[model samples]
Target: MRLSDKVVIVTGAGSGMGRAIAELFAKEGAKVVASDISEERINEVSTSIKEAGGEALGILANVAKESDVQQLIDRTVQAYGTVDILVNNAGIMDNFIPVGEVTHEHWERVLGVNLNGPMYASRAVLKIMLEKGKGVIINNASVGGLFGARGGAAYVASKHALIGLTKNTAAVYGSKGIRTNAIAPGGVNTAISGTITAPNQLGMEAIGRAGSAPMGEAQEIAYAALFLASDESSFVNGVVLTADGGWTAH
Candidate 1:
């Protein structure tokens, strides 16, 4: 139980990497506040955690909204009294359109959720963390942050902006005992709304395109997150740790 007795807030905890991260943290003994836009999914996650004899509170929150973000932090504080770890995992992808083909609405929505959402959620906890004299913020960036794919202009833009924000926070807050970092993960089998067809096909493609490096499991990223949250990475700050399956190694 690396996180035993500590409080954690995980956004987008209803599914995918967020859910896996939340469950892992709770298993390691953290009191987790799991929030998602959907109340049903949020409660389902909470219930599963509780069934596993872990502590969790389900919250319905839209990470892109300032009010909702604030409420997320507030509710966590009220439930577990203080937040020690925050996983900014709530983000939406662009509809895989070229920049010329993308609508303004699509771009704005993607940025709002993927880039601004992390900013708002991190800001919400900054004061509390500053007051407590220590905290960890983990922003879930993507390979999109580092490379421009064929039709991920909006995703690329948003992630690049998020990297900037991550660096800024780490630089500004490291001295105050706050460690801010980001993870750029490669393809993982998650519920990303219908593009991913075959599961093993993804792994096969990853192995080939990424040159034999396997596409990571959500648990792998969760392990990295656990390390970052622990005192193990106390000296580490403002780092963008890439967990891509050697995608950018070339």
Candidate 2:
């Protein structure tokens, strides 16, 4: 058990990549706190974890809200005493549009979820981790963060900022036995569709409808997160691990 006796908090656990990561982490013998905006969705994931003989708690919270982020950390501490891992997985994508045509509402919503939410969650967890003097933080960045115009203005900006946050936090906490890293996932198959309206979000599919790159399952990204969270990555910090199926390479 790579994570035996570990306590992990995973946001956006209601569906998609977050769900897969939470399930995998639990199977590795960690006590997991699975959180999402929808109580039903998060509870479903929690139930599955418990049925598999793993300990888990379900939480419903909007990550963008400070109160919710604080409660999430408080609830986890109450349940497990200490947090060994924090996965900043909660995020939202705006209807992709050129910045020239993007509305302020869309920009705020996108940043609020994808950037501000993670920032708040990180701040809340950092205090706990610093006291413990040991922990890991993984951000769900994107391949879009690496290059130009992979997504609309807001999506790309949010991801870029996430990467920056990962690096900054990692640097700040490295001396305190903390490791912070990010996974820049390419394309993965999940059920969180219908939120994106950008015609050519992936770019590869945009030019001649080339179709999206060879995509991996969300479990693949989970594995990347797992490595960073586990002691195996003790020497690693402030790094962005790319899990995109050759999307960034091309």
Local accuracy by lDDT, each model:
0.84, 0.86
Candidate 2, which ten residues in sequence have the lowest lDDT sum?
202-211
Return the TM-score for candidate 1, rounded to 2 decimals. Answer: 0.91
Instruction: Give a tens-digit lDDT track for model 2, residues 1-250.
Output: 9999999999999998999999999999999999999999998999999999999999888988889999999999998899889999987765556677778998988898889998998898889999988889999988767865566778889999999999999888899998999998877887655576555444423422433567789999899989988988889999999987786676
lDDT of 2 at 19: 94
Q: Which residue pairs in candidate 1 have backbone atoms (N, alpha carbon, C) closer than 3 angstroms, thus clashing?
A: none
TM-score of every model versus the real structure: 0.91, 0.94
The count of residue-pair clashes in candidate 1 stands at 0
Give the alpha carbon lDDT tens digit for every residue of 55-80 in model 1: 99998999878899999888888887
Off by over 4 Å in 1: 193-214
- Candidate 1, residue 65: Cα displacement in angstroms equals 1.0
- After superposing candidate 2, which stretches have Cα over 4 Å from the reference? 198-211
**lDDT (Cα, 0-100) at 151 in candidate 2:** 68
lDDT of 2 at 250: 61
Show how many residue pairs clash in every candidate, following the order shown: 0, 1
